[model samples]
Each structure stands twice: as structure tokens, then as C-alpha cells.
Target: MAHDHAHNAPPSETAMRVKALETLLTEKGLLDPAAIDALVETYETKIGPRNGAKVVARAWTDPDYKARLLEDGSAAIAELGFSGVQGEDMIVVENTDEVHNMVVCTLCSCYPWPTLGLPPIWFKSAPYRARSVIDPRGVLAEFGVELSDDVEIRVWDSNAELRYLVLPQRPAGTDELSEDELAALVTRDSMIGTALAEAPAG
Candidate 1:
């Protein structure tokens, strides 16, 4: 009975790399190299972005739900049954006709991981983290989301335990759609106030 080796390469690379590192650790007589590898794998692969999408989508479809979410985000999200680990005390900021909001973890990368998943490559960079608060309008403009000066901008600074998500304005032409269909209009960044969901075409 021949075993399937082709199905083994990508995962094998990590095992191979770990073994190489483990050999060095063993030579120095370290006890837990394998444990370290396990931790890395558990966090990197098992945890991701789907949770963030769920919350965003839910907010898009339910106005009453959205009101609850904005009033007490952590509790409202917990009501959806998606809270813990990377997301606990979550705050939702609503973007509206009068004001536009955006979130930034200026001190460090504090995010609602249980909701949004891993941060995008650009977000983890220094330039974006720095410029988002100091020049939010400029940062948004780069992403093609322009705003009028009268639309007051409020930037939330995320910290270690608290997380923020944006409640994007519902897309136009979606009033006639079903709840599930409207949910599809929400995007992670849009919910976080960086962008607006694209309107459904007529």
C-alpha cells in the first residue's frame, strides 16, 4: 500500500523547517521546540478573518440590530454568538450622513480578530498606521473614499483589549433586498470606517 506523498508537501515544509530548528535546539538541549511550533501553527492557521465578516454582514442587514450594536457593541456581537479570544470588548462606530468615522490602532495592532481575521499586509505596515490618524482624510483619499470637510471625522484608537469595527452606511438600492442579500454588501474595511460598501447596481 503506497501512501499519498503529493498531499504532504506544503505541511511537510513546516515540519522540515521545524525539524531543522529542533535539531539545533536539541544540540543545545532545549526542551520545548516542538511546543513552540504547535503554538505558532494553532494561532496562524486555525484563527482567521471569517468572524469579522460575520459581524459586518449582520450590521448591514438589520437596522434594529445595528442600533443595538452601536449602543453596546460587545454585548450586541455576543448576541450573534461570536465573541471570545481575539474579540471580547468590541465597540462599533456608525458612519452616517453627517459624520464619517474610521478606526486606527495607533499604539499597536489591536484589532477585532475574532471578527475581522488577520490584518491585511498594508495595515500592519508602519506608514499606514502612522498616517491613518494624523491624516485620515489623506489616507481615505488614497483608498478613493473622499469626504467633505464638514463631515466630522472621528478616529478611534484601539488598544490591547478593546477592538473597533465600523458600521458602514447601507448601500443604496439594497432596501428591497432580503437580509441575507444585504449582508453580502458589507466588507471588513468598510465596517471599520476606512471605506464604504459599493452600492448594489440598479
Candidate 2:
């Protein structure tokens, strides 16, 4: 699969793309550091975790919506107005006692960044990409998540056309908790299905 074009292409071509974007942004007065920081802060606080919490809360309280989320994550998530940008084509995978799901980007890190914010540096690492598929149990062990031998592991390799998210099982003792409180219990890893949300101790 080696391509002569990649080997022969000038490195300056990649650099030029960045240079051109920087030039355009600068000329349009859109590269202000303060404005960029404000935008990042607004999204990081307002949209990303809010979406996760909403999904988790619904799954905890509504059986019908939970079924819909498990069957069609994009449509279920769209119910909360969480779509577009990186979330345009989202898929939600649910983990059960018999089957466990894990996601990785074998080709590139195609992720639901709108709902999950940015992909962590570790997610974009070559080690994670290779190990998650080849040694999923080992990777999960590193994350302190041990699976039973009876459970079958399925690794999803994300493509540009589709993205995957995990819908972790809700914790117990949260039956009376409000949606906002339930949201607080949903963690980033839980949404990825690697970890389960824990109910707060009274």
C-alpha cells in the first residue's frame, strides 16, 4: 500500500496549508487569541458535558428513549439538539453483560468532537490505536476496567462517515435523583463504555 506520491511530495506542501490558513485568519482579524480562548471556554463548558449528561439522564429514566439510543444514537442524541460539526454522523454502542464494546480510530481519529469535545492526546497516539484492537483487555486493564471472561469484546474501528459513542449502564440508588444530579455522575469514560457511572454515596 506504499504510495510513491507520499514519498515524493514536498514537506512544504503541508506547511503551506497551515501557513495559508493562518494568513487568511490573520487578514480577516479572526485570529485573536482572546476570542479563540473565549470560544473554546464557552463550548467546553456549555455544550460537550451537557450533552453527555442529558443522554445519561434519559437512559437512566426513560426506557423507550434508552432503547432508541441503543438502536439509533444519532437520532436519540438529536432529540437534545446535539448535532452538526463533529457530531453529524454519530453512532452509539451499548455494552451489556454478554458483549462489551470499545472504539478506536484505525484510519484516523474520527470522533464525535461536538459532544465529546476534543480527542485527548492519548486517543490520537499510535500506541492506543494499535493496542486497543490487538490487546483490548490489556488496554481496559490499564484503565482499571476488568471484563469477565464470558463477555465477548467487540472493537469498533471508526471511519470518516461514522462515529461511535458508548452508552454506559446507569448506577443504582439514583432512582430519585434529578436529571441534573444524574448528569453529574456521568463521566467521559462512562460515555465511552470503558467505565460505569457510580451513584453518589449518601
- Number of the top-ranking candidate, with TM-score as the measure: 2
**In the order shown, what is each candidate's alpha-carbon RMSD?**
5.5, 9.2
Model 2 scores a TM of 0.79
How high is each candidate's TM-score? 0.76, 0.79
- Summarize candidate 1's per-residue lDDT along 137-188 as a digit string, tens digits: 9999998899999899998878667788887778777768776666666677
How many residue pairs clash in each candidate at the backbone level?
Answer: 7, 0
Candidate 1: segments with Cα more than 4 A from true spot: 1-50
lDDT of 2 by residue, 1-202 (tens): 3588888777697899977897799789888767867887967786675576688788878889988887888888889878877788888887777888887887788778766777777778898888998999998888888998899988888866788887776777887888889888988777765666766878
* True lDDT of residue 188, candidate 1: 72
Error of 2 at 138 (Å): 0.2
Distance from true location, Cα of 110 in model 1, Å: 1.0
Model 1 earns a TM-score of 0.76
- The count of residue-pair clashes in candidate 1 stands at 7
Model 2 ranges with Cα > 4 A deviation? 1-21, 28-42
